[model samples]
Target: MPHDQTTGIPPLKHALTRLLLILAIIAALPAAAESAGKPEAAPDIDIRTAQREFRLSSLRGNVIYLDFWASWCTPCRESFPWMNRMEQKYSARGFKIIAINLDEDRSRAEVFLKKYPARFTIGFDAAGKSAEIFDVRGMPSSYLIDRQGKLITRHIGFRQKDTAGLESAIRSALNRQESK
Candidate 1:
């Protein structure tokens, strides 16, 4: 038997091969696209000192700014004063700022805290469990949570160089709560 000139192979075989290749390509496309903008799931955290579990779910009904920092992070050090001011300004307005420290040594963190005292609650994530939960890729990463306890925004790095924008975010969250 002579093969088809167009495909240089049997017609049925060529068609089947082409069909399979197309299906394969189509199947692989979704996986690639899915990875591009995957939504991260929040991790579980325990606030032992506070005698409360610090899961993301518990933050609902309060506007929260969760800052992930360490004793060694320069930006974190710079941002501390601003964070302190934010805590003082928003605490009575149903806004809570939680600073999750990614430090291994509590003593080091405590010493650092003395230099930059914070009015807000501070939690230690010695094993980096909270960082893993929050999908923190860098120091000074912040997550703004609405009153409903849902994550509204994720800030990867600190560029404000001051707390002006950070205060704005807190105010925005407070405003959003008031509107609703």
Candidate 2:
């Protein structure tokens, strides 16, 4: 093994490390390209929940609220009850709330679920592939998707004051879907 005298490390080892990094970036491209910001089609999510496998495309004709959350996030804990209410209130009207948990440890998410049960669909994404596709930038990021699967709006954090506006957006999307 030829040593790089300047760094005192083998040249072959450094080249292999760089090659691995490049390969990882290349592998991530397809997932990043899957979804973008608002006014575009929502990314397809094929994630497994404890109950069952969830697919975003399966609910194509319904207005969707896609939320990215983690078990340890306080705002995420606050949002669950509100989301449950929304799901119960609007599910019959072709509205669906799909909350994806991004906790790296599945056990933590399970514990959270035990404390605050979700009425709507809950999907686990321990690897964060779905979150990456959605370009989630915060602990609790929410995206509203119209019936046609287009991303309508996004909310970054959960606050009691924000509920009314978020509900309004959900209602508006549902209404718009009804009209069309």
Ten residues in sequence with the least summed lDDT for candidate 2: 30-39
The sequence of per-residue lDDT tens digits that candidate 1 reaches over residues 40-97 is 4334466533345556567667888888888898888877887787778778888888
1-180, model 2: which lDDT tens digit per residue? 689889877998888989999999999888777653337878887968777896888889999899999988999989999999999999999998889999899899989999999998889998899999999999799999998889889889999999999999999988877887
List ranges where model 1 is wrong by over 4 Å: 1-44, 50-54
Deviation of model 1 at 22, angstroms: 22
Instruction: Write down the lDDT of every candidate, Cα atoms only.
Output: 0.78, 0.90
Q: Please, what is the TM-score per model?
A: 0.70, 0.77
Q: After superposition, how far is residue 105 of candidate 1 from its true place, in Å?
A: 1.5
Maximum-TM-score candidate:
2
How many steric clashes between backbone atoms does each model show? 0, 0
Q: What local lDDT does model 2 show for residue 92? A: 96
